[model samples]
Target: MTQATAADAATFAVAVPALGPDVRCHVLQPGRPPLFIEPAGERLLDRAQFRQWSRTVRPALDALILEHGGIVLRGFPTAGTEDFADFIEQFPAFDGGYAGGRAPRETISGRVMEATRLSASVRLAVHSEMAYRRDYPRRIAFFSRKTAEVGGETLITDVRHLAERMDPELAGRLATLGSRTAINFGPRRDADDASYAHMDERGWNQSFHTEDPAEVNRLCAERGLEPVWHEDGSLTVLNALEPFVVHPQTGRKLYRSILHMLPQVENPEQDLERRKRQKYPTGATLGNGERLTDAERAHIDQLCDQTTYSWPWRDGDVMVLDNLQVWHGRNPYQGTRDVQVALLD
Candidate 1:
C-alpha cells in the first residue's frame, strides 16, 4: 500500500488547538467515546520523534481526553516496558500507586505495571478505575505489548451515557444513598490449613507491602478505609463512596459506581450458602448496607451493555482513559496477552 503523504495525513486530522496541524484521527466506532490516533506521514514510530511529538502535543492530548473521554494511540514503536515507561513520563504520574488495588499486578517499570495476572478465562466487568475508593486516579493508561490469539478485547464504555440511560428511581436512590465497598485481604494460613489452599485470595501483606498491622492501619486510614482486623491476620476495609461524580470540565454527572463488578449472591438462598463456605467475602452494598436487588443489578448491567464498545488490541497500542468518564473491562481470551498500565492524576 502507498504511504499516506503529509498532506493526506493533515486532510483527515482532527482539530487540536495546541497542534497547528497533525496526523489522522478516527473514532473507535460510530458515536463512540474513544478517538483513534496513529501516525500517517510522520516519523512517530522513531523513538526520538515519538517523544518529541508526545511532549509537543501534551496540551492538545489533554484537551482531547477531556473532550473525547479516551483515545487509542496505535502503531507506536513501544517494544518493551522501558519504551512504555518513556511514553508515560510525558504525562504526570499518580503518586498513590497500586497499593490498594484489586488487580493482581506487578511493577514492570517505573510507575508502569503489568495490567493484570488474572486467568485468561476470567472475564472482567467494566469499572471506573479505583472507583471503590474515596480517592482514585483521574486517568489510567493501558499499553498493549502482545495480543491474544483469540478474543481479549478491552471493553470500554462512557459512564456519561450510562448516567443518561439509567432509570430515574435507581439513579435517585444511588445519588442519595451513595454506596460502600468491602474489600477483604485474606489471612495467611499455615501449610496445615488445607481449607485455605483452594481459595483465591491476596494476602494483606501483599496488598499493603507491609506485614506490620500498625503500618497497614495507617495506610488504610489515609485512604479513608475503615479497617477491621481478624484474629487470623486477615483484614477487611470498608469504603463509603459516592456513586457518581460531576465531571470537572464538562460539569456533567458521570456514573462512578462499580456496581457491574461487585460480587453478589444470586438470592437469599445463595447468600446463606456463601456465608457458610466463605469467611471474608469482598463485595459492595448501599450506604445503608442493603444488598442491591437483582432487578437493580440487571438494569445497571443492561445500561452498560447499551454503551459498551470493544476492539482487538494491536501490539504497541496504548489506550488512555479519563477514569471518571470511561469504564474499562477485559474479555476472556484463549492465548497470551501482555498489557501494561500506568496511572495519572
Candidate 2:
C-alpha cells in the first residue's frame, strides 16, 4: 500500500503530558491509525504516576502495535536506571532489553556509550546497527542521558516510506539484489579491559551465508553486481538486484544495501582487506560484477541523509523505533552525551 493509505488501520490519543518541548506521553488506541504526540513540557513523571499510567494504557498500546508497527513516547524525566527500567517494564513494546544509565548492558550492537562523561560531539550517520549480520535487531531503544550543545539531533527515516515513493521497477531491481554483508570486530577494547578479536576459524563471515546461492547468483546477474575474490582470501559478494523488503506487519518495503561499513573510517583499502580475510580466509568470490559508480555512491549517501528523522535529545528521553522501518543516526555536538541502547527480537 501507499504511505497515505498505510496507517488507515491504526488509532492514537494523547494520554498525558509530563514535561519538555514537543513531548507528550501518549497512549495509542487499539487497532487504530498511527499517532505522533509532541508534548510541551520538560518535567518527568514520578515513579508511582508512571506505573499507574502504564497499567492504565499498556493493553491499548500493545494492541495498537500488534496492528500498526510502533509508536513514540516523549516528555519523560531523565533519571537513573531504576526509574527507566520501571517505566520500560510497564509497556510491552519495551521488550525488556534495558540500555542506558546504570543498567547499560545487553545491547544488540554489543556496544555501550556511557553517559557519565559521554560527549555529544560525534555525528553518527544513518544506519541500522548490525545490519550486515544475518540476524539483525527488529527494534531499537534509545534513552537520551543528556542533550547536546548544538546540532546533536537524532535523525530517523522510514525506509518503508521511501520504498513506497520509489518506482516499481527500481523497487523490483533492489529486491533482486538480496545481499550478504561481512563485518569485523577487529580487536576492539571491551568494557572489561579486554579486546574482542576477529575470528577467522569460525567462518564468521562465510559461514553466515545462509541464503540460496543460486538465487543470489540470478539476482547478481540481473543487477550487474560483480562478485570478486581477492588473493588475500578476501571475498567481495554483491547482490544489488534484490527488491526492497516488505515488512510482514506494516506491509512496507525497505531498500537494503551493504553500506554498513563506515566509509569515513581510516584505511579503506586495508579495512576492505581485513573484512575479506575475516569473512573468507580461504578466498571467496561473487557471481555479479556490479561496481558502484561515483554517482551511485553519492545518490545513496543523499538518500540516507534525506530519509533520516532526528529526535532532539533530552536527558531521560526514551525512543522506541522500528529498526526495519526507520534508519536512525545522530549529529555531532559538544559536551557529555551518554545514551544506552537496546535491541528487541
Give the best candidate by TM-score: 1
TM per candidate comes to 0.88, 0.60
lDDT agreement with native, every candidate: 0.76, 0.45
Alpha-carbon runs more than 4 Å astray in model 2: 1-44, 63-71, 90-122, 167-170, 188-243, 260-289
True-vs-predicted CA distance for residue 22, candidate 1, Å:
4.9
lDDT of 2 by residue, 87-148 (tens): 55553343322211111123323333232121233345566544433334576656676566
What is candidate 1's lDDT per residue for 190-249, written digit by digit as tens?
A: 222211211135677766766788888888888888888878677788888888888888
Compared with the true structure, the alpha-carbon lDDT of candidate 2 equals 0.45
At residue 71, candidate 2 shows an lDDT of 56
Give the candidate number with the greatest lDDT: 1
How close to the true structure is residue 47 of candidate 1, measured as C-alpha lDDT? 83
The total number of steric clashes, by the backbone 3 Å criterion, in model 2 comes to 44
